[model samples]
Target: MTKFPVLHEEQVREFYYNVEFVEDDSLHTWVGNKSLYLDEELLEKILELPDMHCAGVQKKIMKGEYQLLFEFVNKVLLPRTEKHIMASSTDLFVMESLCKFEPLNLLALVLEHMYKTVIEHKGKHRMG
Candidate 1:
């Protein structure tokens, strides 16, 4: 059994907000002409999971490892969102109330928002 890292909402927020973009000369010819890198410490911590072993998680991020992270975020956030929707009287109230409790739920919202932003950005930069 693999033990995944337990992430707090603050950590997730920090990770997304702190993303560093750099110029990759190799990718200069690519559509966006830019590259993004995550904090190495975050990657190391996540890779510590028993089932995960990689020479470099950052490299894998560009190769689609990020979808794995998104999946984890969804796994954490979806249940809570569902619970709130089922119990709350108003949809607006549920969203507003999401931030009142554990940070994990808030982190889920942030992750979902970021994921959508990335998809939109990628689509705008597509080679087509």
Candidate 2:
């Protein structure tokens, strides 16, 4: 799993795309010299998970809405103990991902974020 997400900064206005860069004002998340973009395809994979897998907190998953699903994805797939507080969530792209059934490739996105965290904070005490 990717260690740190490509978050959008509601605080920083200087950067284009409102993208949060990690450490030293440098873009820590990158692929081929360009910054890494966030992916919502994780949502697609989550949608397909068996109802049994999703029955953890809720008795059953409600398909029409994805907020619960997104939180579940974060908890299980992306893996965070924090439940319900989306962190850096977006809805439109997730809806777009949910609307489509085509196969999604999450490998590269996963790699970049993982690599970014490793390269940026390889030592010392803090982690993202």
Candidate 3:
């Protein structure tokens, strides 16, 4: 079984607060005006991959593999969404923009949020 990473909440909060969003008119419009949410099924699929544990995932993101990461994100996470479809051809472009501008900051934010979300869901199920 794959385990989600246990990120330090304080560090994650600091990163979340400090990360800057660069102005990109194209990507901004492509992503739409809503907050990006990861798909549960995509998260599960990633967790199931033998080589896709938390540390490895983080390493890949930090190593500038945003294209691959977003490939999975677009295919499994955001597929079928209007925003995703609209930006399908421009996935690489947007990812490059994010990598060049935000670096690993955005990835860290997403991973931190995803980990907390999974934990909260598991807790709810156990309690229910």
Candidate 4:
């Protein structure tokens, strides 16, 4: 279980807008699911970890302190993702590429999730 850092709207937009194309497709599909991209239950578990705390992660990404992002990507996000994608497939290269895509996809996933989360949370708060 691992918790992702809180990202601002501007940062999410920046990351989404700056994405590179993989062939004709926008590589956007690599990061899908606005709600619970990296296992919401697991994310919740990670968040509850005593050692964890929220940080302004997007700023660090913009500043190119990718190690922090990499840690979360490699250790927490990628492994779980790989298990699903690589389960039936045997191609190491594709698996490797997918693993690489994990971090970038993570950014995409987080941004999309954040956007949806804000909208949903606000909707609930306002309605309730």
The models' CA-based lDDT, in order, is: 0.33, 0.40, 0.39, 0.36
Model 2 steric clash pairs: none
Ranking by TM-score: 2, 1, 3, 4
For every model shown, what is its TM-score relative to the native structure? 0.21, 0.32, 0.20, 0.19
Candidate 4's TM-score? 0.19
lDDT (0-100) at residue 86 of candidate 1? 22
Query: For residues 1-109, could you state the per-residue lDDT of candidate 2 as single tens digits?
Result: 7699776553222223234554432343343346544333433355542211101333134354565656555566555333444333222233334557533334333
Please provide, for model 3 over 5-110, each residue's C-alpha lDDT reduced to its tens digit, 9 standing for 90 to 100: 8878655444333333333211111122333333334444555422111112232333345646576656764343233322332344335555566333233334
Better of 3 and 4 by lDDT: 3
The ten-residue window of minimal lDDT in model 2 covers 50-59
Q: Provide the clash count, candidate 4.
A: 0
Worst 10 residues of 3 by lDDT: 24-33
TM-score winner between 2 and 4, please give it: 2
- Model 4 segments more than 4 A misplaced: 1-103, 125-128
Cα-lDDT of candidate 2: 0.40
Q: Which stretches of candidate 1 lie over 4 Å from their true place?
A: 1-104, 123-128
Best by TM-score: 2
Could you tell me the TM-score of candidate 3?
A: 0.20
Q: Give residue 6's error in model 1 in angstroms.
A: 26
